[model samples]
Target: MNPVRKRRFILVSALVVGAATVIGLVLLGLRENINMFYLPSQVNSGEAPRDRSIRAGGMVLEKSWQRDELVSTFVLTDRQGSEFTVRYEGILPDLFREGQGVIVEGAIGADGVLAAREVLAKHDENYMPPELADMHLERPK
Candidate 1:
């Protein structure tokens, strides 16, 4: 065929292939992200993603929290009081207190529970503090 026609055909094919390649890579990257955000109950029930990164959220069980001086061993519990003991070797967030909220990101073990690579303790809100939440919650508005 004509050189102009051949060149245009090649350009179109290249653009289509390039777009497909970019979409494929983005989909691959999102595969791990898709398996994210599970509740503690879900985690305990074996619903967490072991092959990818995930976020596990729940209420820190009161009285179930224990910090080991020798190690950073601790337990996190759900709203139902179900507890999952976690072993982390790093400085925990200042907001990581008992009965507070937390959302951990990592992988789940074959034995169950998360083998967390990153732990994020959630507080009441950006403005509200735990003490304030407690005061407001304890006393009626």
Candidate 2:
């Protein structure tokens, strides 16, 4: 084999290997950071992954909100009535309320309670500002 051709082959092979390594590393990083969304029913049925960050969305169960010092605990219930306990330490959003929609980001502990890092309130499509709630503005047909 010619010297020049051999050198070129080696360079091309190294470039291909380097590209593959970079792509593999990027995919691995994404896998570690990606969080999956699940419903309360899925969590109760053992379908949700444990020990990894994930999102669980449902309605806050009525009369389930409890606050003790900094930590707050509540139950999230899905349409099917399946429920899961969530504990959060940070200040909750003003929209956070019982019987309202909420999505929690956290990890499920072995004891089956979610250690929430963040909580987001989900609102309906027709939701209006609190200041406008008293004003009944009908949608234009």
* Per-model lDDT: 0.72, 0.89
User: Which regions of candidate 1 deviate over 4 angstroms?
Assistant: 1-36, 51-53, 126-141
Give the Cα RMSD of candidate 2: 7.5
Considering every candidate listed, which one attains the maximal lDDT? 2
RMSD of each: 7.0, 7.5
Against the true structure, candidate 1 reaches a TM-score of 0.56
Give every collision pair in model 1: none
Deviation (Å) of 77 in candidate 2:
0.3
True lDDT of residue 92, candidate 2: 87
Clashes of each: 0, 0
Cα lDDT for residue 36, model 2? Answer: 46
Model 1 agreement with the true structure over 26-137: per-residue lDDT tens digits: 9999985675467777667766656676777777666765567734545676757555766565677888877688877767666565666777887664577789968887
Question: TM-score for each prediction?
Answer: 0.56, 0.64
> How would you encode candidate 2's per-residue C-alpha lDDT over 49-137 as one tens digit per residue?
89998899999998999999989999999868799999999988888999889999999998899999999988778867866865554
In model 2, pairs of residues that clash are: none
